[model samples]
Every structure is written in C-alpha cells, then in structure tokens.
Target: MIDEVMFMRHGRTAFNLQRRLQGQIDIPLDIVGQWQVDMSGFTLAQRFYWAKVSNIARHPDRLSQPSDPPIRRSDITEYEQAPASRRRMVVVSSDLFRAQQTAHAFADPLGLDVTLDSRLRERDFGQWEGMSREEINERYPEGYASWKAHEGGEAAYGVESRPDLGKRGSSTIRSYCDDPQYMDEPTTLFVVSHGSWIAATIGNLMGLPDSQLDNLTGMRNAFWSRMEPQYTSNSVLFHLTEYDKGPDVADAVDWENGPAYLRNPDMPMWKPLI
Candidate 1:
C-alpha cells in the first residue's frame, strides 16, 4: 500500500507579495496563496480515494515494516498509481506563519492535523530578518555578498549557515519520522518550509553543494517532489522526486485561514473520520 507523505506550498505571503526575505518571520497568506491551499486540498482529496483503494489491493497483507512499499502492479494509473499509495504520506511545514498556513492546504484534504514544528523554522536571518533583497543589496552590500557565497559554521548577521540550516531541517524531519508511531505508518513525508531551508535540505539530499543553491529556490510553491529511499530514517530524504506546479481553483479565504472542513456545510463531522 502506498501511503505517501506529501507537502503543499502555501500561497504567496505578505512578505512574498512585498518581495521581502520573510525569514523566520510570521506573515499570513495573500489572496493568491489562499487560493493555492484550496487547490492543493482539492487535488489531494480527489487523489486520496483512489490511493486508498489501490493500497488495499496491493498490500493485501500488512507488512508491518516501514520500508518503501513495493509495486504489485506496473500498468496501473500511470505514475500516480499503486506503488505511490503504498507509502504513508504526511504533510508538515516550518513554524513560520506562511509555511504553516501553506501546510494546512495539504492537511485539509487528508483530514490530518498539522504539527507546527519550530525546528523546521526557516533559517534565523538575524539582522537581515525583514529586509527586502533590494534593501539588502543597496544597504548592506558586503554582508549580502558573503551571504550569497560564504555559508555555514560562519555567522552572517548571526544568521544560520547553509550547513546549520540543513542540519536543523534534517534534524526536524528525523526527530519525527524516526518516531515509532510515524514510521509504523510508512509515510511519504511532505514539509512546507521556506526557500533557504528548502535549498539547503534538498541540496544536501541531492548531494549538491553551496554552488547549487540557485537550483533550490527555482522550485515553485504548491509544487511536489520525491526522493529515493536513503536506507535509514535519519538519512532517507528527498531522493527520487516528482513535482507538480498544482492545479487552479477558486480563491477561498474563510476556508483557507483555518480549518473550514470542520464547518463545511456539505461535510458531516463523523462521516469521513468514522
């Protein structure tokens, strides 16, 4: 059975709308970001039914292990089929307002509660916390220069280095994924973190170094990716990956700001849960 833990990027943030760093800052979602969450919720909800049915068929007998679920059939629903559903997918995010807000979009569809993890927080930018990229470039040119190049173990504005951020991000994932309860489920984990942390964690997972930071931010929000198994929970990360830019949907805020599913008129509280 494929129970994949997935991530959904929160829509544009107030900082994003304003083009600010937003590092470790608390900011809510903009109109477009709210829309992204609704869309992610719908996509995941639709995909959930089929994935559930397939898992029941493939892993007819419970394996009792957390390793990747093997493919029982190849000619299924193409790539988004059998093997995909075998892994338990969990959606998580950095504690930043934007990241948690974005994470809710995915959890909404799965009927799961998100854990607002602080260790998953974006790199603490210290002095550069709220400045826009342009402001940094025009104001603190030297620090910006070092920031864009020199990394990790060296403090930039007391900001976290690439390695430090990577370590933290990885640590957060390991802390939970290693938990007996979570691993027993064999989930495909999704983390809704920010650009800098995303870059470092993904970069290190893919074996790219500081020179490849540019490749990390290029990934779009509401987008999804995957990684091959790393053998152990601590080391297994973003290996073989897949990304979807996400679908389009009507803009909905009252639904996006918090758990509207609990109050959705068409939804019966005990129906899905029971």
Candidate 2:
C-alpha cells in the first residue's frame, strides 16, 4: 500500500496575483512564484530531516535497527538516499505550465521524475477563463448569479460542469492508487495540481458529503497537504493528516483541523508575503 500522498498546489502566477480565474490557462510562475517554489523546496528538505528526527526522538529503539533509514541533509538539488531510506518519491503533475513548474521544484531536489497527467489539470473555466471575479460579475452577471445559486453545478456557457470535475478527481485518484508500481511499494507520491482539483481530489478520497465538498479550503501556493491510509478489513480509507496554510480566506477548511504535528511539525509557518 502507498504509505502517504502529498498534494501540493502550484506556486503563484500572474493570474493568481490578479485574482483571475486561471482554469487551465497555462500561466507561468511569476518571479515571486519562482522564489516561493525555491524556498518551499528547501523547506521540504528541512521537513524530511525533522520528520525522522522526531520519529527517532519518540521511538529510540527504532534507531538500533540496521534496517532503519539514516536521515541526512541534502544539498537541496541532489539527495542521497540511505540503503534503507528509499528516500524515493514520485511527483505527478498537471500538464499545465504552472503545475509542471511547481512539480519541478520538488522533483529536482528529491531526484524524482515528474509524471505529467492531464487528469490532474485545473477545471476548465471556459468562458470564465482568465477573468477576475469582478470581471465575471460585470460582464456575465446572469451566468455568475446562476453559478452561485446552484453552487458549482451550473457555470458559464462552455464551462465544464462541477459534477464532471468531481468525477475526474475521483478517477484520477482511483487510477493512480490502482497502479501496480505504486501499490507494490511504500512510496510517497506528490501530486502537484491546481487548487480546485486538489480540493476535489481530497474530498473524494475522504468520501466527504456533497454539502461540505464546496466548502473545503485550498492550500496556499507552494504549500502542501498530506494524507495517509487507515486500513480496514474490506478496504482502505485515507485521512487528512496535515493542513492549514497562509493565503487562505475566512473559513473554508474542516477536514484535518490542523497543521498536525503527526506529519508536518517541521513545515515552516505559512506567511503570505506575496
């Protein structure tokens, strides 16, 4: 079984800065976005160190086992894995430019190949693509109102339906989980995609109710959320382990209710500098 899945949102973009609807527009990361990815990569390096350190501190006997992985610092671009460490990871990213860029940030440091998957791309915004909220409200008032009234079920002309997006999210997870390569190892998979896709994927994995689905918040740019398995007799269920990041709006998250120390005690505190 896959040990854990980490979902990370792409870094900031020109459209993100303007609060514009990206929706698979293929925007490149801006300067600040590039910096965010760089720093986030370093943070990930630190995170691995602290994760093992904490585990050792908590369970001393585990250290005596030669099979235990030795935790060591990497130069951020090339990491050497101990024989036991498997320091291995897989990065799956949306085909869009921004998402690919974000995946590269981590893949470069962790020495993992990025698997490009269109299934992980952001929802198709269609007519709303590249438009800001105010622009949508001003130019397509009726369509905007309809979308809001029906939540995501309805959308502007040519837009993909919310139900379809949900289905895609569900299928993406199912397909990846069913892959023999991933299932055979205790691999850590990093899924780099857009905000909407990430939330929808997580919600589907957790089997959250429909009403609560739309309310799930997204992580900040360059930030990540973690999920791990809860094995059951008939099947395995995944649970959110760590969350809570900056650039978030009021009250959108309800799943994890934490930047839980269980998996992410070492992550840097989120600061919305951009």
Candidate 3:
C-alpha cells in the first residue's frame, strides 16, 4: 500500500525571482535555488530515515517499551544498511528541468532514481508564459482582472483552467498508487512539481471547493506538503498532514516578500527534524 505521498515545489528559478510566469518553459534553477535544493534535500533524507526507524519501532512485535532508550543515529544507520527492497520510497518529478533538478537532490541521498512524468508539469500559461504580473496587467488588464477574480477570462488567454490542472495532477498521482509494482509495499512517494499544480492537486484530492482552495497560501520554493492515504472498503482517500514545511528558519518568514536569507551561501542549513 502506498501510505504516504509528498508533493514538493521546485526551488526558485530566474523567472520566479523576476515574478514571471514560467509555465512549461524550461527554466534552470539559479544559484540561490541550488542552495535551497541542497538544504531541503538533506532535510528530506533525514526525514525518510527517521520515518523508517519509527515504522520499525512501531511494529506489532517490536513495539518499544516505556523504558526503552531514545532513538540514536546508530539506529538510523542500521536501518539505512537494510535491504533496498525493505525500504521502498519512490521519487517522481515533473520532466521539466527545474523540477528534475529539485528531485535529484532528495533522490541522491536515498540512492534512488527519479521517475519523470510529463503530467506533473506546471500549468500551461499560454501567451502569458514569459510575462510578469506587471506585464500581464499592463497588456491585458481585463483578462488579468478576470483571472484574479477566478472567472473565465483565463480561457480567452489560453491559460489552463485550475480544475483541469487539478485533475491532471491528481490522476497522475493516483495512477502511480494503483501500479502493481508498488501496490503491496508500504511505499512513500515523493512528487516534485510546481506551486500551482501542488495546490490544485491537494484541493482536488481533498474534495475542496475552488473558493476554499483560494484561501490556501501558495507553497514557497523548495517547500513540501505531505498526505497520507486512508483505505476504505472500496476506495482510498488522502488526508493532508503537513503543508509548506521546509527548513526551520523558513518557517517564520515568507520568502516571497521577506529578506533574502536563503540566497546567502553563508546561511546555515537547518538541522534535521529527526
């Protein structure tokens, strides 16, 4: 059974810094984006190790007693040395360059390969692909207003509808869960994608209305959300557990408008959560 799915947004890009719509454009990560990926990747690796240890500790026959010693790094090391088949976490990413760059960071630490899926790409922004918010507002004021209102103006501009993007993302994830190779294993699937896609997909999976989804904040670069599957007799439902989690320092500031601490190469990487 695929128990957990994590959706991660790719690190910042030149277009992201310039506040331009990248859409399906093949943008590479900037220097700062590379730094963000390195930090996030290390933290994610720690989380994977900790989760594996916790699972073993919670095993029916091996439950830890109240007096048991605290989990140590040695314990995690031991778990890491276990057979590969016993640790079945799969990393999947959008085939776009930025997403693939972010995916490799986390995958490399776990000695896993990243599986690319085109369906996970960012929403097509059409003619507005290279435009910044300011440019869009200046060139297509009415369409911009309509888009802000979540009306149908975006259709005229050839942008992918939010609902369609959600369906594409959600269905892509569902297909992986239903695959026979991973169906019987307690697999953890990591999907490295884009901000809008992640948000839309989460809203769709949770069966939330567009109005409710509008209230949810967009995920920052290199941040991730986690969902766990709840299996019923006939269907599977995913429940959101964590949202927009990343390095500890990032928790306090909105990177989009805040100071450029993440851009500093000297900034210390956060210690592992585990």
Assess every candidate by TM-score.
Answer: 0.67, 0.73, 0.81
Predicted structure 1: lDDT? 0.59
TM-score-wise, the better of 1 and 3 is 3
List candidate 2 stretches off by more than 4 Å. Answer: 49-83, 150-153, 231-234, 246-274
lDDT per prediction? 0.59, 0.69, 0.80
Sliding window of 10 residues with minimal summed lDDT for model 2: 254-263
Question: Higher-lDDT candidate among 1 and 2?
Answer: 2
The digit string of per-residue lDDT tens for model 2 on 1-274 reads 5677888888878787678889989899876667666656666755554334333333444354344458553232211233324434667899999988988886665445688999999989998899987888898888888787756634546777655676797788766666787665466777888888888778877887766667787677778888886557766678999763432321343212222322245333323334
Candidate 2: deviation at residue 52, Å? Answer: 14
Candidates 2 and 3 compared: the better one by lDDT is 3
lDDT of 1 by residue, 155-246 (tens): 64677777767767666655665567765546556678766666566666566765665456534555555554445533554464555445
Candidate 2 is scored at a TM of 0.73
Q: Candidate order by lDDT, highest to lowest? A: 3, 2, 1
Q: List the residue pairs that clash in candidate 2.
A: none
Give Cα distance to truth, residue 183, candidate 1, Å: 3.5
- Each model's total of backbone clashes: 28, 0, 0
Candidates arranged by TM-score, highest first: 3, 2, 1
Best by TM-score: 3
